[model samples]
Target: MFKLIAFDLDGTLTQHRSKLDQTNRKVLEELDKKYKLLMVGAGGCERIYNQLNCFPIDIIGYYGMQESVMNNGQLKIVRSDFYTVDKQYFIDATDKIREKFGYTDYAGDNVDFHETGAVTIPLLGKSAPIEEKVAFDPDRKKRAVMYPFVKSLFDGFNVFIGGSSSFDIVKERFNKYNALTAYMKEHGINENEVMYVGDDFGCGGNDEQIKTGGLNYTLIDDYRNLGNKLAFLL
Candidate 1:
């Protein structure tokens, strides 16, 4: 039996970058009564908290770069960490990758820089239309082929095939695996006593490290069926 259930937001709980629906929200409310629910996200803590409509639950964001907990029905930051990055270095490196992969002609910004020193290499450019971005790589086959190359370029960063058409890059020390383990340690819980539910657990997927890192996890490919996937827990 699991003592805690940690969830990944985007693909696991809802459509990418969308708010949680009333259906899933009700499921979560029911589960919350039986077990602690946590959201582990690739974005910032505040972003995830807000996206959930400020649902009162702890959040580990930016792949563990930040942590926030709900206090008296409100989310409060408990801990956060940011890494310093060489901005020019990323810009130059991304350019080389783009040139090598024929991604030279993009719509807007070549790379997206996050506040936590993380970067996103949006293949179609940051300003690309949403429809095109959605159609860019539905199966992720295209990005998976170049994942190794991108990962190699970002030597000290954790690279993942993120979003619909981009790669998320963060400091190597920050990742879902480390974040979950650290959370377990901090809460005096055993790894086996926790279950991670996420959608991206395949090759180059953001949640891959958690599976490979020897953690108990459940996969939910379609966010619409999240409630059914955790029916046993309910």
Candidate 2:
């Protein structure tokens, strides 16, 4: 009864920022024959495309801020949305959180301002080593404790516990739920006809909105088990 299968990239299909593995890739190949596949991710469309090694599937990126489709064997971004943020405001706001939480020291940059207007407040600094970031909050406990405070500080923006040690902020209108719904409306697919798969559905997690929004979804706790988690579909 399903016509589409959407997925989260990192943590669901592969390790964070890692390439798609052969097992999942083969699974996708099989699924593509029967249902449309989409990559709905927190990163940009192009980045997701390449990370998948250009696996020919439509992609919705930046939580709906961007859209891309396969064109002549290449992924072409067809739509992109950008918002202007008060840079100084974010800087000052993040500083306040850092000071209150005693995260006054960090490596690289305090916050990453993406071109799409999305913002990442890296708690350990953007340039921190991968190992350190991964070890900082594997269970998201630390981020959860501060999630509400971060949200309070950024009233107009949607805040999510992102990556290994950071918060991803975007406008309230954009999220995996809204993005998936918009795609369904455009393609004439019903809410019941699509299934989303992701790993992060915990509080403040990036995929929490979709799970809470009443969409049909399956959770993959470990990327290595993605094949088994979705075997029923195959």
Best by lDDT: 2
lDDT string for model 1 (1-234, tens) is: 788999999878887778899999988899899888899889888989888988899999989988999898888988878777888988998898898889998999988988778888899999998778878887789999999898998887889999889999998888899999999999989987999999989988999999999999999978899889999888
Q: What is the TM-score of candidate 2?
A: 0.97
- Return the TM-score for each candidate structure: 0.95, 0.97
Clash pairs, model 2 backbone: none
Whole-model alpha-carbon lDDT for candidate 2: 0.93
Q: Give the TM-score of candidate 1.
A: 0.95
Clashing pairs in 1: none
Instruction: Return the top candidate by TM-score.
Output: 2
**What local distance difference test score does each model get?**
0.89, 0.93
